[model samples]
Target: MLLLTAVACLLNTVVAAGGLQSCLHTRLSPASTLVSPSSAEYPNATVSNNLSWQYFASAVVFVGSAEDAAIAVKCAAASKIPVTPRGGRHSYASFGSGGRNGSFVVDVTRLQSFSYDPKTTYATVGAGFRLGNLALALDAHGRATPHGTCTFVGIGGHATCGGYGLTSRLWGLLVDQIVRVTAVTAAGDVVEASPSKHSDLLWAISGAAPSFAVVLSFTIRTYPQPASTSYFDFDFGNFSDTPSLAVKALLAFQSFAATSAPPELGTQFTVGRSAGGTLGLRLSGVYYGVETAIPTVIQPLLDAIPFSPISNTSKLQGYMASVAFLGGDDPVNTTGRVESPNTAYEKSIIVPTSAPLSEETWTKFVEFAFNTPVPPGISSYYWQIDAFGGSYRGKRTAMAAFPSDANAFGGRDGLLLMQHGTYSDTSGSYPAGGHAFANSFAGTITETVRTEGKKIEAYQCYVDPLLSADEAHALYFGHEKTHKLKALKHKWDPARVFDYPHAF
Candidate 1:
């Protein structure tokens, strides 16, 4: 959300004091306070889930409630400062911190409130609550909702940007679960957007929220926990070294997922190099059904692949156990967040079921993944594709069983969401070719598809900071959606107060 200042933010100490005092003067709730650049807490306030854009914020107001959020926004506007709403602080491009200095951040992570209604099966979660905590809290009542695997991701941005959970195939994207949202608009109005109220605003906030408002809370629908699941893991060690075999296996997996995979299955394919530079591919997923049925479903697909798995296994797990297993850790932290921030660059591509990745695209994917050599100053790199598989043979719904016009989320027809990322060895620094290295995959895909008279998209959740505003908006949301969003943006934020690069 970096404002287009070609140079860095001006560091006039007066600007900080003026903005901080303006909000504090409003008498924020007892628990709310503003942290200035001079404060000892400034460093922590400027950080989110990523280290790449740990820019110096002009001030951060840790809002305790929706009222506090409104006050922070109004105060920032009065002081002529930009507002960046900080939730779990996990904007890969650091939109939570504006990706630049002089950002007046409304830190909402302190407003951790949760309440559930057993009678209605609805959960009203404060925007501050992390996904992990939400999972645990809902599990206590034997209820759950769709969300990302990363526990620390805030429900606000996650839902706003098409949150894709492991259970999304069975349920739907997190945005589909959002029945209501309470927010502070550009004009400092405390409002609630829902199906029955502010309906248009509700549609915008459901996906492109940052372009319009600072969402304070979300009321979402929840479901009963899964009775049982079979967590399957398949390893094809160093298989990518042989492009032909890897391509064949990858195509087999993709074919099974796109054609015959059931709604209960959630699978991801990952190809990366080992410590010794051995390229390999791994396939893992969760089948939200009886454990014994695993072989009935996955076994045939495994047999179809040209490259045999080095080892394959499946384990029975209940709802919470399976979530923890796939997430790499139990979402447990009593005092603070669970984090290991990285100096990373990210890119994404959304593969639709309508046109599937063609032979040219798959061949290019194999080439980029295996034949490409690691560049200098890159600590780690890998690309993983999550197939949002469902019953998609034209008889049922699309991704997550939602219609294309369901909300602002543009990937409703996606069969796969591909993430290309590279981590720098040193914090806050990226190699010269780092951007190009990760961009190559999606870049090549776009080129191949265009020649065939088709267009492609990238997953908005995995934000690519390098793309121009127009390009990002167009790819993430199509020309039609972009125009619609821009019109809505003009209506809601005519002054462009809630401004960000690539935000409509």
Candidate 2:
């Protein structure tokens, strides 16, 4: 029923208006810049990476402009080589790992650019633009987009994989604002996908992996700047002792946030390493308007588990500055950057909004995440859940292609359950052993969650390889939607030019 046709694309020399020669040129005059594998800068270029905690590509091609990227993609096609687009590489999955298949790495760093059309209220951004840079750019214009807390994370890939962050409760999703995308299709054609043109391609790109093509730029809808943004933090040492309290707190806050939380207020939850050796459970947020109304909105959550007020720096700063605080000032700035030389695998699940959260599942999850013995440098994470529902609750357009029950995703107004197991060091003698350990831990968690009668639909880019095809389908597209996705794959990338490890 599926056709994996390998169509041969014909290269051409039609230069775009006043640009450089196309990839079909025989003389191959070097453009403004080119970092080849044999060049002196190759070693350094190949090793560069954002935080995702792994190394991947053996060779890296740092593309400077869309034209340069177009050339690279064309060259790869001509040479019969595979290509992987590189952004922040922040995912924990092997999605960007190129592996040993000799996939040419196309790094979009040189494509970083951000500009706005005030009249239209849109931000035309380069594929390489990180949330931090974009936030700074947007702040200059008194405009903002719902880029997540990690400032340095790439917006290109983030938008496609249904970008989310603390602000999700306020702005819906980062992808919701996407108006148009300029990309090079697998067929070697430079095209634009948007609501007006190539709408289906646009649909496939959002909430989907980079299977359609290599996106060079995205033009997204922007919103007026909020009057002010606020931040809050709380720390609890032992997670297991307050199960009932935490549940009651979570439930009460969920109800309040849905009905009464000021539209200006956006909240977040995080359970991980904090300022001290203490592993903290913190609830922090941003208020788009006056901060005076936030305390009332979050009071229910606060009442559940009172702890030492580690630090509460609530202020009326620009969105960019708020992003800096949310991302925190870290050494590697791992809060939002991608991993270089991508080496690890990422896994995530969108827990249904209506799906019941059993005490058994919660207790088991907390134990595995906090009590599990993680390798020294290696780490795992659990995101804050306080930030959900707001404008993001009813974006049926976003769930258009998602095979699962839209309601299951917290009733289409669901809270996303994000988790990842990261390996910081892959060169040690215990490399295989470390992977085995993480896998075992993950299996236990998955099994336990399954035993409780819940399902996990992963972000396409974060589907775990350990899952069998059927298992992956169930985890990713829900039981019924997986088949439809396969059909989409057949309709678009029949030749599988954008294929990666199990990217069907």
Candidate 3:
């Protein structure tokens, strides 16, 4: 407790210096105390409630107060140790774990405060703001940001690492809409970065931002959202046998992508676990305007899926209602401040060369994701495959410090696919074997894609740092672009204090 108090004192000084003294003080928990793994509550408090063992053993604990987060960086700099900014602890890999050896970690859960500028149509969100809380706040104001599908995703990492959501088609990637970000550099100096201000730093923070620096807060542009949004789900049961059906439906979805999509209309494909080892496909959409148009514009999709004459609801429900339908109840606990463990998993965010869902590639995906168990728990999930291109193309708008490609951002049309293996153990704990299983699963799937001679663009957030520099480079924006990013990292983080694996 004495150590906790001392740390809190130092934290107050650091955050105060950064012009956040009052805000930080107000957000700190009245009864909260910083606990370490060495503390009695360490075991339970250090790991997320749902998934344990997703972090490494050497993580240092910072109990409470956003001030503690600032102090954590200062301590690390003085000691010449590294630190990772942690909030929500939902990252699948150990990217949030600064290093294997004990490193100072700025657990920023206590800093979860948000202030809105209704006049400016902007939201100044603290680094610790949780997605759900953000959602509630915005919904009350009849405005919203394109946050994650899961409510618990932290806005700090989500925005920094390229936050995506159903509204991406209308607004843009979460990072794309961010106007400014407050980040603590390796030197422990707080800097406000944006496209116009610190152009290069802003360019590198998103998609492939270096983690060595701690992101403090982000000010994002928000939209005058509808009073209520509606979500419609069409589930295609018995997916393995529905290849032809899948092909036809996917093609129609691609057509939707090519056609001018209404700013109010956002659509995606989700294939997930079903009864009897069968694959399930859902052509889902969220429309900001009249829920009535859902059936009309989505005719192509409805024609292909196996919707029955009488059983089909072809329904439209409210935004909050849709949240329940999408399994928003799978609570993402924001209470714990510990980091997620360093475990391996098979993951990829690939944008294919084309928008059409090729039958051949779909078949290959099915086989790789289900038939092969190289990494036992790997599963295939796609958010916006065919429909991604229509909304996210051809406009160079102001974005935050996160980088965006002119072609990829709004100039060209494309889709983002997140294929991954979820780590789960029979014993209810992710053991060492679980890590090995995930790695093998990822390798086997990627090899198959290579063998098929298909080239796909990769999203850097889900990538593991273990891949070779060349491999990682190619997986990112390719060798040439990767080189530029590496050079930028060196230029910005000369001392490499914010170092993390594969952080180009």
- The numbered model that scores best in TM-score is 1
Q: What do the candidate models score in CA lDDT, each in turn?
A: 0.80, 0.58, 0.56
Candidate 3 steric clashes: 15
Model 1 C-alpha lDDT per residue in residues 442-495, reported as the tens digit of each score? 666878888888768888889987788899988788887888899999898887
State which candidate has the highest lDDT: 1
Per-residue lDDT tens digits for candidate 2, residues 31-80, read 42445445687555545332333343434566666666667666766555
Q: Which regions in candidate 1 have their CA more than 4 angstroms from the true location?
A: 1-20, 274-276, 333-335, 389-394, 397-400
TM-score of each candidate? 0.94, 0.78, 0.77
Local accuracy of candidate 3 as per-residue lDDT tens digits, 217-255: 778888876656667666655556555555555555555
Model 3 scores a C-alpha lDDT of: 0.56
lDDT of 2 at 392: 27
Model 3: runs farther than 4 Å from truth?
Answer: 1-34, 48-53, 57-68, 99-101, 209-212, 274-276, 304-327, 330-346, 353-358, 367-386, 391-403, 406-413, 423-454, 461-470
Evaluate residue 377 in candidate 2 and report its C-alpha lDDT on the 0 to 100 scale: 49
Candidate 1 residue pairs that clash: none
